[model samples]
Target: MLAWAGCLGYAAYYSGLDAVAGISAGAVAGNGVHGAVGWLFSTGDELGRAGVYALTLAALSAGSVLLRRHGVRELPGAVVVLGACWLFLDSHIFWPRGVFTMLAFAVGFGLLTVAASRWSGRLTNP
Candidate 1:
């Protein structure tokens, strides 16, 4: 739980402001359908994008805390999905931080899997 919170909190605080700009810049650099749309529509341009990122960060943080408190097993899967989304979205944007964040989330997923396997009788031990 602390790990999840820490990961999300760090991402939210560090990347929150830059995420939108990074995404836009990355999109322009990546040059794809999403990038084109972002460029054309100016979705999340500057402060707007930052706001969205902040809100998303808050949501993720809250979700992580809630999942941990409730002992929900789906938290790991959620983290993986969120990480994948960040990876894909940021890949389009060309942000290095996005790549780093993706890596963090991937590692978290791996850790979660290992932990689950350790606890569950269904897992075969080598």
Candidate 2:
């Protein structure tokens, strides 16, 4: 379940990047009823859709590798999901600039995940 939450977190973060870049990106890469397929290959645009793909793939692969390598267990799925949701929603409006608080929340969310494991009786004690 934590793995899924991790995936969600990665996806949401990328979505936020997409919002910042103002590009369609992979958010709608393969939609059946859309011409957005070409959006990923757009070269005229500075951001270029491939950047999104790269960021997304990097996030997913890195997140999975780091989680598995460190034997990180006991991640609270709710915190992840909620945090991702908040990020996705907040990313929709980047003009006013609120990413600072979001960054703090992300840090807290990471710490919370570890703390959740400890408090849930899985870890001996932090």
Candidate 3:
């Protein structure tokens, strides 16, 4: 999921759409055909593509942390997915442009995921 979003955003950015691809990036984080349409329309023109690289960075970084927290441990799907994104997906945007963004997103989402994991609400505690 995160790899798909990252690759899609990277490709969109390279196509000269600037950051407007973020719309599709956020949209693709979920499921369904709406994301496909959003990716197509957003990348096709100049509208709704702002902050795309940042979106990719956030999704990938946060998703990696979350994957680590989960049980994808046998093969380390996070590393595998990230590596595949860089190798096959051509994630130059992440190396040269979005490294800092990825770091920031990683820290932010890591904390959030931890806090959420520790949370014990009325319903959850029961």
lDDT (CA) per prediction: 0.53, 0.46, 0.48
Off by over 4 Å in 2: 1-49, 74-105, 108-126
If both were scored by lDDT, which would come out higher, candidate 1 or candidate 3?
1
Q: Which stretches of candidate 3 lie over 4 Å from their true place?
A: 1-92, 121-126
* Index of the highest-TM-score prediction: 1
Per-residue lDDT for 1 in model 3?
61
| Candidate 3: worst-modelled 10 consecutive residues by lDDT | 84-93
Put down candidate 2 lDDT per residue, 32-57, tens digits, no spaces. Answer: 62565454434313232333334344
Model 2: pairs clashing at backbone N, Cα or C within 3 Å: none
Model 1 agreement with the true structure over 1-126: per-residue lDDT tens digits:
444554464455446435545655567667655546455335434444444355356546655654665456647755764665455443433468666766766666565566555556446856
TM-score per candidate, chains pooled: 0.34, 0.31, 0.27
Lowest-lDDT window of 10 residues in candidate 1? 40-49
Candidate achieving the largest lDDT: 1
Candidate 3, residues 1-126, lDDT tens digits: the string is 665666566565555543444555546555565647666554634431333553446456656656555434312334443443343232334665456545544555454455445542323554
What is the Cα-based TM-score of model 2? 0.31
C-alpha-based local distance difference test score of model 1: 0.53
Pairs of residues at least 3 apart in sequence or in different chains that clash in candidate 1: 26-93, 26-94, 27-93
